[model samples]
Target: MNDGLAAVLAALVGLVGAVGGAAIGGMAATRGARVGAETAARATARQVQDQAAVDHMHWLRGQRLQAYQDLLAAYDAYSDAVKAVEQWASREAGDAGRRPGEYVQRVEAFLRAHMVIRLVGPVEARTMSAVLWEALQTHAFKLQDWALLVERRSGDETIAGAREELAPARAAMVDAHDVFLSEATRVVGTPMGN
Candidate 1:
């Protein structure tokens, strides 16, 4: 009976050892799986963030392109209007009535185009764009004043004075356009029209 009791005690010890080993191994596996899952979650989150940044940059590029296009269009329209008004002033007094509203429409178109610049232009480009707009506005005002004087059949000296007033504004507009183009190229590659 003592030998039987010893044998049973030995078997019981073996069973306890096996159970403890299995519990420890299972805990180790569970901990490893938890760490692996956490790693995967972090990787997935980083990928998603990277993708969002790429998408945002693409959208911003498109906006910049459109804004640049609009600004160029505005500049062209304004420039043509100024030329037209100058031509009208040079024309015979009777021919001046043919397109009295054309210059005004062009100025309005230019003002409308500025809205796009405000919406999508980056800070550097925006500053240049503002300078361009102010110069164009000054040119437009001087052109309008000159047109009025022309309609009144004012002397050549008065008309020449108005024309002279436009020179500085034109120079400023050209300088601003050049700066804006340079900044835009830095930001979005060469401009479409160029």
Candidate 2:
């Protein structure tokens, strides 16, 4: 009777030990899996955030490029209008009439473009654009005044003298245009936040 009782007791102890070991092993595996899943989730979130930042930077670069192209085109149109007006001024009585409205429209287009640059800029380019616009406006006004004087025969300054007087303003506008191009190009070429 004592031997049978001892065998039964030993069997019960072995069963409990096996069950306890399995439970501990299962708990450890669950904890390890949870930790791994959390790490993966964090890594995925970080990757998404980094990708969004890159996309935003690319979009901003494109916007700036478009703004610059528009501004340059508008400026060219304004310059052409100024030339047209000057040519009209030079012609004698029997020719086509002047289109002052066209000049005003071109100026408005250029100003709109300049305003866009002011909205999206690297400050230096914006400042140069402003200086360029001011110089151009001054030159255009001087040309208009000269044309008026010529039409009315009120001023003694000849066309040659008018050209000489405009030379400095033209030079300043050219310089400003060059500097704006340089600064804008540098800004576009550099990486974000640099």
Candidate 3:
């Protein structure tokens, strides 16, 4: 073979080998980059999931706490109504003849049925709190009926008589307080009695 031809052939063989080696190195680099990307994606997904779980738990806890607070406030109002009833009963039993107000019965029923009355607020009425609240309101209304009965009595109705009518309202209010315990339970994703 001619020297020039042999030299050209050798050069071509070296070029082919160099190109082959470069291609293998490129494939290795691509494989390493793919593994790194997959690992990073998995880590990011895990962090997002953990954060979401934490946020959801916090929201649930808040709802439960608020429910208890609302129920407690309702109970406090009911207790106040009961105290009024005790005072009324005492006054009626005493010899002093202080006449009660005509609307006294209204006040008494409001106190007795306080739970149902207090629940009448738009937001609370819409909630699970509404059931007991409606019952209390109804109880208070019934006390008004009692007052009407007294009004139609053959004997002269004194202010004290009207005031005494309020006694039923006051009792209903106390019952409303009792029922609030159940409403609060509903807020926590549990049954009221539970």
* Candidate that scores best on TM-score: 1
Ranking by TM-score: 1, 2, 3
Model 2 lDDT at residue 88: 77
Query: Top lDDT: which candidate number?
Result: 1
Candidate 3 residues lying further than 4 Å off, grouped into runs, are: 1-15, 31-35, 89-128, 143-194
Q: Which stretches of candidate 2 lie over 4 Å from their true place?
A: 1-3, 93-96, 150-153, 158-165, 192-194
Root mean square deviation (Cα) for candidate 2: 2.9
Residues 1-194, model 3: lDDT tens digits: 99999999999998888899899988999998999999999999999999988776665556455545655554455445534443543443334243234334444443444444343322442343455555555544554454444444424456456556566666665565565555554545543212
Query: Which 10-residue window of candidate 2 scores lowest in summed lDDT?
Result: 92-101
* Reference-based lDDT, each prediction: 0.79, 0.78, 0.54
Candidate with the larger TM-score of 2 and 3: 2
The digit string of per-residue lDDT tens for model 1 on 1-194 reads 69999999999999999999999999999999999999999999999999998788778788888788777887787778777777777788887775465767777776777777777777777788788778777777777787788889788898788778878877887888888878777878744322
TM-score of 2: 0.81
Model 1: residues >4 Å from true position, as ranges?
1-3, 190-194
